[model samples]
Target chain A: MFKNGKCIFIAFILSLLATPIMVAAEYGDVLINNYSDEAGMRPVVFPHWFHRIRFRCKVCHADLGFKMEAGGNQINMLKIIDGEYCGACHNGEVAWAVENCDICHTGKPGQPTQVHQSTASKLTTTTKRKQAESVE
Target chain B: MKFKHSLYILPLSLSFALLAAEPSWRTLVEDGLHDPTSPAIGVLQEPASALSLLPPDTTGNQVSWIRALREGYIEPRTNILPETKIEVLDMDIIMEKTGELSLVMFPHKPHTEWLDCANCHDKIFVEKVDANPINMFAILSGEYCGQCHGAVAFPLTECNRCHSVARSSFTGKPGVQPISVSD
Candidate 1:
């Protein structure tokens, strides 16, 4: 019984350590809601992971003039279409077009379903359905 | 008697003329429009040119504190590697540690110029909003900011440099003023 209790205590400590990691994973992944709610549209889930892999931090931040603070950059659909903000690379030829709103606007602010569509698909049942519904 | 009256009348008329010659609102407006060098000009309002206000090396460098510390001036070097490149981004994250204390203004541009993303990301600071507690106590003991600040970067003694979010109600304590680049 003594050995079992010690093992349980160590397991508890390990779980506590893991909790922060889970939360930290979501960092830098921003919810771009500059004018989304005001315009009756969903806020965008701009995955830093997705973009960071393909491009250096300088590409979007320095050359493309993206503010480091998420949503700090003045991003608009019109600007993207004009090849200004997200439009710089999201033009049909370079990457996915800005017309694909559902890709970025996958997260809901208060709802538990507020994970990125790409990640949501891999997660359990509810988030996957949420992504599908958002597409629809 | 006629000469005395003429002298008094001449003086009174001249006085009125002088009073009228003093600049009117109309004249001031006209002067502002026509004269680019007028006191009313926006740029001229500041006595020194914008470039002159910054350090010589940082004049056109967009004011990176990290760069100024490393290359512009020398001090006791830290073990950590310094960042290269002159890239600057003029954005600040205002962190409200406590309602009583002033908020911290985290400027990223200069830091990014010096260090890689991995240096602090996920390790020291979890690149998320409202994630790190980042209190002064922890910082003093060598946690979040103490990771580099006291060790290599500017020491935490410079309190006002980070806690520089402007608040109307705040009557700042000594050494708690906003970080001005001129210093």
Candidate 2:
């Protein structure tokens, strides 16, 4: 009985480790899930590095008016077809048209739009020696 | 006979270039009119002349735009509208919310050079100082600074860039307050 319980514990721990990797995104994959879950569709996992391959930062952020945050822009099918945000380029003109539903929206369900490898934890890596003196 | 062979190559290559759907949109989407690859493809016109022609970087995107801009290789327009006025504000805010890590010094000079105030104000960060809840965990989840630092900007690996101020030498700047836990 003891050996069986130990084996079960080991199996449970292994499963826990595999869960994060099952649908893990790469470093620059941004999973956007604001409206996707409610609409019964998979969240869009935008490959930031892929787009960066050809364009500069200002091309999308400045000229195209894309907000920096995930789900920052009110992206939807109607707005996309009408020539806004992604539709500006993906509208069967410069790049491939959004005919295939699975192209952009292929993230796991219920994942909030976010960067796969963001700077959050890395920023806190260094332990503080002392807190700064408070100003009166 | 040699001249005839050369003539055959030119048309052959031109056909291949024109066979693809409309000229690439690298520079087209920005201004709807500039297609550098077309017409000039035969002459090997630097398509996307509007963009810097620098060789793509091996690490990040093929183009090192920040370096290109900083080194004055290219001049990108701040806005699509030519006549729109751009206001660049200079403000420095400090955050002491970090437990033991160095205090964060947030500056607006470089950011305003490229972005409008609305890009972050009241959206990513609250206009009123200390109103927003900021922490490394929230940022890792793509909140606050994480939205841009990891996505577009220089990235989060360069920690000292933001946490530059040493607690001992920090005399504090005017009009700036430190971020902390309580209201």
Candidate 3:
């Protein structure tokens, strides 16, 4: 009985150590917003993990001089479409075209999904590439 | 029972007396704080030539450039100019556990030239000295002096920077050793 109690106590300590890793794994989404004084403004969310693998930090942050703090960078749709901020890279050659608004805006709240099937399919292709590289 | 009640009341009465003796809010604000005669605001108010490359709107539809410029550049000037008057403060480092305080005078002006005002102001030394609550543990953990001493400015590996002279009898661990003064 003494040996069984000691084993249970050791297992409890090991479980406590594993808790932080499990909590971190659950967090995978990114939240981004252009600083606005307006009361209600839906900010765009850019997935960090998806972009980090494709581009370097200096490409967007240091090169563009985006502030280190979140909600600091000033971004507009017109500036982006004109190949200024995100448009500089997402202009058909790098990722997705800026003409496709639904790709980023993701549509209004409770609205029907306007799916960009081409971008979604391309994402799968990139994921396959990453998996293939990992296997090697 | 009466003695115990008086003991508790004594601390409460003393605290009330101390509060009554404290300066009023208006007096504290007017005289106690470091009221600079002419506080120099760092960063240029006008748009510099570097920012001229940004696109302009013809109809004034876009946000004002001046407003954007002001929001971006709000920093206080550090008083470390060559001609400015500076006072050096002596600091003590315990070499051993003798409870003895050694004195090493710190130069203000030269150090300010290399650091931004935010680097020390409100962080290491508060605008008011009595308001400063610097924890040595926080400084060692990279909150105050540790921010630059170990990074871009200098590495705090040397022993003589803060201590200046080695004490023959002292024995306690060093707080934060000064890095290279020179670039």
Among these predictions, the greatest TM-score belongs to: 2
For each candidate, what is the lDDT?
A: 0.51, 0.61, 0.38
Tell me the DockQ of each model, to 2 decimals: 0.01, 0.08, 0.01
Model 2: CAPRI class: incorrect
Which prediction has more favorable lDDT, 1 or 3? 1
Q: Model 3, residue B118: what's the lDDT?
A: 43
**Model 3 CAPRI rating:** incorrect
lDDT of 1 by residue, B49-158 (tens): 32223333211112233443446432312211134344444445666655665667677766665445555678779888778888777776557876555433455666
lDDT of 1 at B53: 38
C-alpha lDDT of residue A14 in model 3: 95
TM-score of chain A of 3: 0.49
Per-residue lDDT of candidate 1, residues A10-121 (tens digit): 9999999886322221213456667877776656656543353345455565456664444557788888888997887788876778777655554453323222222222
Q: Estimate each model's TM-score.
A: 0.32, 0.49, 0.27
User: Could you give the candidate ranking by TM-score, starting with the highest?
Assistant: 2, 1, 3
Model 2, position A10: C-alpha lDDT score: 92
lDDT of 3 by residue, B1-114 (tens): 999999999999999998775422121112111111212112111122222333332211111222332244212222312343333222322223213434232344334433
